[model samples]
Target: MHRIIFATGNEGKMKEIRMILKDLDCQVLSMKEAGIEADIVEDGTTFEENAIIKAKAIMELSGNIVLADDSGLEVDAMDKAPGVYSARFMGEDTSYDIKNNYILEQLKGLPEEKRSARFVSVIACAFPDGRIFTTRGVFEGFIGDKISGENGFGYDPIFWVPEFGCTSAELPPEVKNAVSHRGKALGSMKEKLKEML
Candidate 1:
C-alpha cells in the first residue's frame, strides 16, 4: 500500500484523520511517526495557504505524498476572530478549557442568532511529482453559551450544531466525522487520492 504522511502533531486531529482515511488503499502516518520534526512557519493569511505550506514542507523533507490541514473555528460575533489562529488563540500553550470559556465570556449576553459561527478546514496535498491541490470544507452552526461535550477537541465543545441539537464534541465520533469540516475536506481529498491511486 502507498504511504501518505500527514503533517500534524495534534493527537485529536490525528485521530480524526486516521478514522476518516482508514478505508483508503494507503497507510496514513503522522509527522512524528515518520520521524519528521520541523518548525514550519505558517504565516499565510488564509487557511488554504497554511495547509499548502505545511504539506510542501513535509513533502520536501520526506519526498513522499504529504497531506496537511489547517482548520479553525470562526465566531461571527467576534468578526470571525480566532479563525486561522484557532490553535494559537489566547496563546499557544493555553488550555482549551480556558480558551473555550474565554470565548463564551466574550460573547456573554449575545442572542442565539448573534452567536452564529462555523468551522473551516482546508486540506492540501503535495505529491513527489510536484503536484499540489487543495480542498476546503465548512461546518455552519452556532456558538453555545457554555462550553460542553467531551468527544471533540478545541472549539468543538462550544460549537453548537442545531441539526443535532448539541455541540460538535457531544456527537459520536462517527457522527462528528460525517459532518465535520475536516471530515468534509478529507472526504474530498479521499476522492482525489482514489483517482490517483
Candidate 2:
C-alpha cells in the first residue's frame, strides 16, 4: 500500500478521510505518527495557500507525499469572516463551544435567508519533488437559529443544508461524506491520484 502523511491531528477528520479513501491501496498517517512535529506556519490569506504551506512542510519533513486540508465556515452575512482563521476565531485558546456561541451571538436577530453561508475546503497535495496539487470544494448552506446536532466537529452543527433537510451535524457519516466540502475536494483529486500514482 502507498503510504502518505496527512498533515492534521484531528482524529475525526482523519477517520473521515480514511473512510472516504478506503477502497484505495493507501495508508494515511498523521504528522505525529510520522515522528515529526514541525510547526507549519499557516499565515496565508487564503485556504489554498494555507493548505499548500501545511502540505509542503509535512512533505519536506517526512520526504513523502503529504495531503493537507484547510477548511472553514464562510458566513456571507459576516462578510465571509473566520475564513482562514476558523480555528482561532474566538481566540487562540478558545474552545469550539465558545467559538460557536460567539458566532451565534454575533448573528443574533438575523433571519434565516440573510444567514446564508458555506463551508469551503481546500486540499493541497505536496510531493517530495516540490510538485503541488490543489483542489477546492464548497458546501452552500445557512446558519441555523441554534446549534442542532452533536455528530460533527467545527461549525457543522450551525450549518443548515436545505436539500438535506438538516444541519451537517445531523446527517449520518455516509451522507455527510457524500456532500461535504472535504469530500468534494477529495473527489476532485481522485482521478488525479490515479493518474499520478
Candidate 3:
C-alpha cells in the first residue's frame, strides 16, 4: 500500500481523517508518525492556499503523498474576523474555552439568526511528482450562545446545527463524520485518492 502523510499534529483532526479514510487502500500517517519535523509557515490568506502550502512543504521533505487541511470558523457577525486565523484568534497559546467564551460575549445580545457561522475545510493533496489536488467542504450553522458539547474540538461546541437542533460537537462521531466540514472534504479527497491509487 502507498504511504500517505497527513500534515497535522492535532490528534483530533488525525482521528477524524483516519476514521473517514479507514477503508482506503493506503497507510495514513501523521507527520510525526512518518518522522517528519519542520516548521511549515502557512502564510496564505485563504484556506485553500494554506492547505496547499503545508501539503507541498511536507511533500518536498518526505517525497511522499502529503495531505494538509486548513479549516476555520467564519462568523458573519464578526465579519469573518477569524476566518484564516482561527487557530490564532485569541492568540496561539490561548485555550479554546477562552476563545469560545470570547466569541459568545461578542454575540451575547444578538439573536440566533444574526449569529450565523460556517466551518470551512480545504484539503490539499500534493504528490511527489509536483501535482496537487484540492477539495473544499463547508458546514453551515449559527453560533450557539454557550459551549455545549464535548465530542468535538475547536469551534465545534459553539457551532449550532440547525438541522440537528444541536451543536456540531454534540453529534456522534459517525453522524458528525457524515456531515462535518472536515468529513465532507476528506470524503471527497478519498474518492480522488481511490482513482489515483
Task: Give the poorly placed runs of model 3, Cα more than 4 Å off.
Answer: none
lDDT of 3 by residue, 1-197 (tens): 99999999999999999999999999999999999999988899999999999999999999999999999999999998689999999799999999999999999999988999999999999999999999999999999988999999999999999999999999999999999999999999999999998
Candidate 2 residues 1-197, lDDT tens each?
77888899888898888877777667778887877788777899999999999999888878999999999999988899988999888786888778887888889999889999999999999988889999999999998878889779988998899998898999999889889999999878765777887
In the range 3-112, model 1's lDDT, one tens digit per residue, is 99999988889999999999998989999999999999999999999999999999999999999999999999899999999988989999999999999999999999
> In candidate 2, residue 119 scores what lDDT?
94
TM-score for each candidate, following the candidate numbering? 0.99, 0.97, 0.99
Report lDDT (CA) for all predictions: 0.95, 0.88, 0.95
Tell me how far the alpha carbon of residue 116 in candidate 3 is from the true structure, in angstroms, after superposition.
Answer: 0.5
Cα lDDT of candidate 2 equals 0.88
Clashing pairs in 1: none
Q: Of the candidates numbered 2 and 3, which has the greater TM-score value?
A: 3
Model 1 ranges with Cα > 4 A deviation: none
Q: Model 3 TM-score?
A: 0.99
